[model samples]
Target: MTTILVTGAAGFIGYHLSRRLLEDGHEVVGVDNLNTYYDPALKLQRLQRLTAYEGFDFHRFALEDGDRLQALMRERDIRVVVNLAAQAGVRYSLDNPRAYIDANVVGFLNVLEACRHHGVEHLIYASSSSVYGANTQMPFSTGHNVDHPVSLYAATKKSNELMAHTYSHLYGLPVTGLRFFTVYGPWGRPDMAYYLFTQAIAQRRPIKVFNHGQMKRDFTYIDDIVEGIARLLEHRPAPNTSPLTGSAAPYKVYNIGNNKPVELGRFIEVIEQRLDIPAIRDYQPMQPGDVPETYADVDELIRDVGFRPSTSIEEGLGRFIDWYTGYHQPISVAP
Candidate 1:
């Protein structure tokens, strides 16, 4: 079993991925700052679940702390470093730009340094579907040019890809960036649209429909995402024979999405049905840094990993609603 370091262990994706790794008999070291971007209590709950596994180790520290990160990586003999920690949310970045620089840019740099110093075999990190910003392309592809980002959050993620490429080229680090689509599932982040939508619907509050209720998103399920990462954990990138870059670096990027985009109104319909309630619609203008739509081209991901994500919107929403009701019991969501 290989020893792995998973940054952002308490976050939605990190927590699920780490749990899957531990179940497969791998040793895992998880790190997180537990920032109050949403709720630290949920983050702590995730950590608590992970602690039940003997093979999982927890570290509560921000990734920008280079010294601490270096020490943890060096001491653990981590073979694969999955950097998942970042300041998420496109709109949140508009409110607090400094958080993006600190967590996404600087924290990522520290991770790259540690991997370089420790001779990490494979470096896997989270990139977002938002990196496809401003592109008129129907389905986003990793080979496509991602120079026009609409939001600071997207820009930072794009910057991460470029920064990771530099390390891969200069230091021969085998880096793979997985561009995640709008992922939703049980134990999901409270800040995500689906999570909030579910909450608002349950509370009989107005659910905001952005883009004048015309936007679409490639809402990926969490289980499919974790499975893709688990498979890629063994599929490290090789030196570029024909990489997106001219430099011969073992770096690559893939769009890990459901390859299906669901319109905003339809998504809300699913949530309302699950709650058996008629949602009070609140039509709002698109916020800054928000995209009109996101569609993923997972041909490359399927070809490379021999896998394709296949979860219907209804099924995924049902699972989430079940978890939501259980988590917040004694509160009736009867429509």
Candidate 2:
């Protein structure tokens, strides 16, 4: 069985992807620091599920620790590497920029170095939809210039794409960078708007509606993200042979999004409908590093991997609430 290494295996998307890999009978080596970004308990709970599988092996450490990461990759004989470890949250980055540099930039460099020396066959890493900063264009495309990033988090992720391209060009390491849109569903991040809004509405608290409820997001579901990543694992990029781009690099980037931009008001309305309660909406001005809307163009993703995220917000959020109720137990708060 081919062994693959997944960083940030304790985080939201990482946990889901690792579990999916284990269920497919692939040997997976998971690495995570399990920091108190939100709650270590939730991360541990997710890890506990993967630990149940015989093919899953986990190590607790930050990706910035190059020595440990290299050792783990070498020892595990990892054929593929999926680097998902990063200090997420755009607002958090504004407050703590160093965290983003330490995790997303330094940590990602370590991952690249490990893949290079260890002879990894394929390297798939997470890019962000936030990288399309200041571009008001409809349905952000990968071919568009992403030189401008509004947030430190977006800048770091954009840096990752550049770093991966360097590695691919220099060492012939095949790399695929996925620009994920607003991903939401079960086992979601607490800092995310969907989860936060759900919690507030459940507690009979006023939910903050930023930008005066004028925001739009292409909320791709977690299952769809996992499916897209799974399909791209085997489809490694080959060196570009086109004359338009002179450099021959085995690197590619794809946007994995639902391609359906739902308005913020409609999204909250869906949540209210699913939970059978109305939310106390508190309108607020736009926060820093916030975008007006995000709609991804997944044409390249479909052409390359033959898969596209198609989960509607209503169906996805319904599944999330069902899981949330069961996981959190009897709801004491108002609905």
Candidate 3:
């Protein structure tokens, strides 16, 4: 069994990945600062489920602590390092720029450094679809140059891809960065549009329809994301000698998303139908740092890993709502 270190193990995607790794009999070391970016209780609740597994270990810390991170890497036989931890949310990044700088920038640097020094076989980290900033490109591809980022969150993620390439070039670390679309499903981030919309619709409150509900997102499901990740974990990129290697770096990026782009209005309609409640509607112009649409071109991901995300919105949302109803408990802190 490989020993895998998953930063942000308490977060939505991290928890799911860690659980999958454990189920596959891998030893997983998970770390999270348990920051109050969202509700720490929710993060803790996710943590509870993973901690019950025998193959999992937990640490509470931030990515900026490079020294501690290196120490942990030394302490564990980490064959694979999946950096899923980050300060998430585009709108929140506009409000709290410091968090983005601290976590996404400095925090990610530490992760790169730890993996570089720790004999890590593969380092797979999260990127975002937001990096396709202002590019009117339909079906965004990772092979495209992502220099223009609209949000600080997107900028940091773009920076991450560049940083990983440098590390891969100098240290020969097999690095893969995944540009995720609007990933949603069971145990999703509360700040996400799907989760928030679900909560509002459940409470019979008005769900803000952004950009007059003209927004479209390639909403990938959690299971599909985990599957893509799991597949990549096994398929580490090989160092290339050809010019395509772009300075001999063992680094690659791919867009992991459902090819289907669902409009925000139609997405909400599905939620409303599921809950059997009409949403009080609040139509608003698109907020700052919000993109009008997102579509993923997963040709590289499919070609490289032999798998791609295909979960339908209906099946995915149904699972999310079911989890939401069962997990809700007055937002009490997990003891």
Candidate 4:
């Protein structure tokens, strides 16, 4: 069983990945600062479930503490590192740009440093589909140019890809970056559109339909994401010496998404159907740092890992709403 270190073990995706890893008999050392980005109670809830496993261990710390992180790596003898911890939210980053830099930039550097010194075999980190900002590219591909980023969150994610490439070039580290599209499902972040919309609809409140319901997102399910990640755990990248860059760096990026873009209005309609309650949509202009549409081109992910996310919005949302109703207490709608 491989000893895996998941940086954001308490997060929505991280928690799921850690649970899957533990089920596969891997020794998982999870680290998180348990920051109040959203709701720590939710993070704690996810963590509590993970702690029940025999091979699961938890650490309360931020990734920026390079010294402590290195110590943990050495202490745990961590063979593979999945860096998922970050200050998430595209709109939040506009005012809290420093938080993104401190966590995504400075914190990621520490992760790379720890991997470099700790003899880690593979470094797989989270990247966002937001990096394709202002591109207007249908079915965003890894080969497409992603130099333009509209949000600080997107910029930081792009920076992560660049930073990983640097380490892979200099230290021969096997680095793979997964650009996640709109990931939603059980135990999802409260700040996410899906979760927030569900809460609003359940309480008989108006759900804000951004861009006047013109938005589209490649909503990937949590299980599909975990499956993609689990499959890639052992499939490390090799050096690309194919005369493109003329350098043999073991670094690659793939878009892990459903490859199916669903309209915002249609998504809400599905939610309404499941809940048997009509939604009152507050159709508003697109907020700042928000994109109109997101579509993932998973050709590379499928070709490389032999798998891709295919969970339909109906099946995925059904499971999420079921979990939500069971886990959450009664909701009080605002008058």
User: Could you give the C-alpha RMSD of every candidate to the true structure, in order shown?
Assistant: 1.2, 1.0, 2.7, 1.3
lDDT of 3 by residue, 9-58 (tens): 99999999999999999999999999998889988989999989998999
Candidate 2 has an lDDT of: 0.92
Model 2: weakest 10-residue lDDT segment is 326-335
Across residues 1-335, which tens digit of lDDT does each residue of candidate 4 receive? 99899999999999999999999999999999999999899999999999999999999999989999999988888989999999999999988999999999999999999999988899999999999997787989888999999999999999999999999999999999999999999999999999999888988989888889998999999999999989888899989987867779998888999999999888999999988889998899989989989999999888977997989999999999998887763653333
Candidate 1 local lDDT, 186-232, one digit each (tens): 99999988988888888888888887898999999999999999999
- The alpha-carbon deviation from the true structure for residue 27 of candidate 1, after best TM-score superposition, in angstroms, is 0.7
Question: Estimated TM-score per prediction?
Answer: 0.98, 0.98, 0.96, 0.98
Pairs clashing in candidate 3?
none
Off by over 4 Å in 1: 331-335
lDDT of 1: 0.92
Estimate the overall C-alpha local distance difference test score of candidate 4: 0.92
TM-score for candidate 2: 0.98
